[model samples]
Target chain A: MKNRLRLLAYPYILWMALFVVAPIVIVVIYAFGSAGGGFTFDNFSRMGTYLPVFIRSFKLAFEATVFCILLGYPLAYILSKESSRSQGILVLLVLLPMWMNFLLRTYAWMSLLENTGLINKLLTLIGLSPVKMINTPGAIILGMVYNYLPFMVLPIYSVISKLDYSLIEAAQDLGASSAGVFRRVIFPLSLPGVLSGITMVFVPSVSTFVISQLLGGGKYMLLGDLIELEFLGSAYNPYLGSAVALVMMIVVIIMLLIMNRFGEGEEQAVMI
Target chain B: MRDKKSRVPGRIFLALIYIFLYAPIIVLLIFSFNSTNSRTVWSGFSLRWYEKLFNDDMVINALYTTISVSILAAIIATVFGTFAAIGIFNLRRRWQSPVLTLNNIPLMNADIVTGVSLCLLFVASGTILGFGLGFITLLLAHISFNVPYVILSVMPKLKQLDNNLVDAAQDLGCTWLQAFFKVVVPEIKPGIVNGALIAFTMSIDDFIISYFTAGSGTQTLSMVIFSMTRKRVTPEINAVSSLMFVFVLILLIIINIRSSVQDKKLRAKPA
Candidate 1:
């Protein structure tokens, strides 16, 4: 049986070799090699060009992560406390938007935030001045929260659902206040889920050009935009694009390492 | 006693969050049927936009491409991912985690990066293959991204399974192939199905990857919708968006039903 199964695996081995393994191999090689002439340090040396973009993308990602955690924690707690049937419905609600196309979800925000859109229409009807919600940092942040909130909510919910309520009760019996119980028990127990969600949101938000480009209207240049410009825009510079990609990868690795450090103590709490 | 007032505020907070989450989608569905072109005022609801959506040839082509790519990607991902999951399980226990993580790289990496890199690969290959980027390249890209999800889903089930069952089947004089098909396949079927469902969703919902890899002729529904919204905030898009919203909603319901039934059956089984 094992031998037969091993034989069946060859097709998948070939598939991964051609697809997942090969494309990444090409990128890693090209990241080191030069663009036109030959292998050189030219692309690596031009890292200075992407410095501002790295900062901007990282800062925005940081802001989005913070917001997701803040909003998501309490919501997840409530969801975990709900009955199983209601929890299923709540999960479906959170995941439904995720099933819709990313671009569609982004456009939904566009409809909401456009000058003549629903929000402004409502504000004007209410006798308040219409606010410019599109093409701004705030709009981009709103889009980020809308699109990425599920990542935060799902992991935290998973952890909270699996939490042993008896531990909380025990803490309460020991005369711990509600806040104290949360801080000492629930919070620490849920940190792994929090880490996973944070990583999920942060990585995408930092590298996401679509939200910043569509919502911020190209006024805000994030790292992904910079990479896109080099590769596809008028510049058409693959070398510089590859360099920027490498830098982005490094930044993500650093972010993950930080998360890993903080997550070490919390790994015991992983619910999934 | 103090928790009662606190719980009221918590309930209100939950209500507000639900309102935030669902309001945009509700607005989208409502405006899709608005009779007037303007969104500010709602005239009597009509189906004009839905009619227009059917007549748009370009939109039709995009939907065709999207469905085609998603199906092909789902099939390929399920088959390959199931095989890979089984293969990794047959290996020594210690090697599994790293192998699993390696397979997950394509998932964890940013979609835009994957899109760009796949574009580069296609661009490079088109030179050798003498075929410009189109359906084939798009399928390849979708398969690459979808496979990781399949693996992630299937591996856990394979890990939980007992290996001795397969060995015992072989001891009973069944051929290795027979044992694999009759024993191993049934054990992991749920995981494989779940993986395929996720792959289907991911393949259909993906915009960034599809945007880069798909040529003009192979543009998916999302690409068309994206371009349309960029140009004009038309109600036809809303109509199509609402349709899509309903389609996914139904899919979610079906998945829930299947899962609950499976849960019941599993609980009924003796451990």
Candidate 2:
């Protein structure tokens, strides 16, 4: 029975090796190997030219992550304080938009942000000047925050809801001010969720092509857009695409390591 | 009085956030019922887009592909992941962490990276052994990405399970297969179901990976919607989005009700 049970994992192991491990290995080889199949370092060196794109990607992703934290934390805190039934319903409400196709959601934003769109129409009706919202970096950041805010909220909400209210009460009883109690007790306790949320938002935001493509109107080029262009656009080069992907993977892995450190080996709870 | 004042601000803040989160979806839903195709103008209420959606072969094909691929990927990943979790749970402590870390790589890695890497692999292999990229490669990519989520979801349940029950069942003259089928499977059924649900959602929501892996001829709903948006925004796509939103919303409501009932029953039991 033990042997049979052990044998059950063989298929999974084989599949992982062939599909997961081998593809990554291929990516590495393509990143380092020349088009003629000889080893070369040109791909890595060529990445230097696209330094601006990389910086912009990280900057936009960082800004988006900050916005998500600011907006999501309060909502998550309030939801955590709700009755369990309302908590369930409110969390579902937050997550329901995510169930709709992300492209559609972004498209909806595109329409609203356009010059003659609904928002501008509303602004005109109210005697306010219409602001240029589309085809800008701010628009891309808005799309990122809109699409990935749920990722930030769910983890933080899970952590905050699981927190023991007694700790806050204890801190207050010890003559701590309300702000001090939150700073010393609640904020410190929720760091793991915050870290996870940051990674959850930043990683996808940095690596997204679709959001920038739809919202940025092709005027703004992020790292994702650059890598995608290399593979599928006019300057189609798989080797360079692999190199860019390799670099993005390294950055994401570093973020994951930081997340794991803050998570302290119990990261599964934040999956909600 | 102060508590009430503070609570009002928090409630208002939450309301504003909900509005922010839902504004796009509400806009999409309204447009889905609009008579005119223009997004800015309301030409009266009509279900013309929904009617057009049903008649569109391309949209129907993409929908079919998306649903089938997600279901297939979810089932296959769940089976493999359940067994893998069991096997890893039974392994020596030293080996378990390394195996789990490997499992987390795909989950932690960016989708664009995974998609590109898989695309390279398929292209590389095609040159060497004539393997091609299309629906099969897309399905494989989905399954590979989904397995880790299933493993993560199931491993915790496996840990909480009592080993003694399985041992007792085996002692009652049950074979290994019988014990596993009757005892272990039932014990971890919730985790298995949860894992499948997560896998299904992940597979269905996936776009970047499917975009790269799906060669020119194949398209998932996401890929179709993406291309449609790139060319021109169509009301038919809005109709499809509305249907998908309602479908998932209904599914989630059912799941929530069932779980709350289970929670009530568990609470009613004596400790």
Q: In DockQ, how does model 1 score against the reference complex?
A: 0.58
Error of 2 at A178 (Å): 1.3
**Model 2, range B1-271, lDDT digits (tens) per residue?**
1456668888889889888888878888888999999887889999999999998899999999999999999999999899998887777677678778888878877888888888888887777988788889888899999999998989999889898988999899888789889999998988999999999999888999998998888899999999899996877778988899889988888988998898899899966
TM-score (chain B only), all candidates:
0.94, 0.96
Error of 1 at A125 (Å): 2.3
For every candidate, C-alpha RMSD to the true structure in Å = 2.8, 3.2
Candidate 2 reference-contact recovery? 0.68
Candidate 2 residue-wise lDDT, A105-187, digit = tens:
89889889999988999999999999999999999999999999999999999999999989888988999998898777887
Maximum-DockQ candidate: 2
TM-score of each: 0.93, 0.95
Worst 10 residues of 1 chain A by lDDT: A1-10
| Lowest summed lDDT window (length 10), candidate 2 chain A | A263-272
Interface root mean square deviation per prediction? 1.8, 1.4
On a 0 to 100 scale, what is the lDDT of residue B205 in model 1?
Answer: 89
On the 0 to 100 scale, the lDDT of residue A74 in model 2 is 83
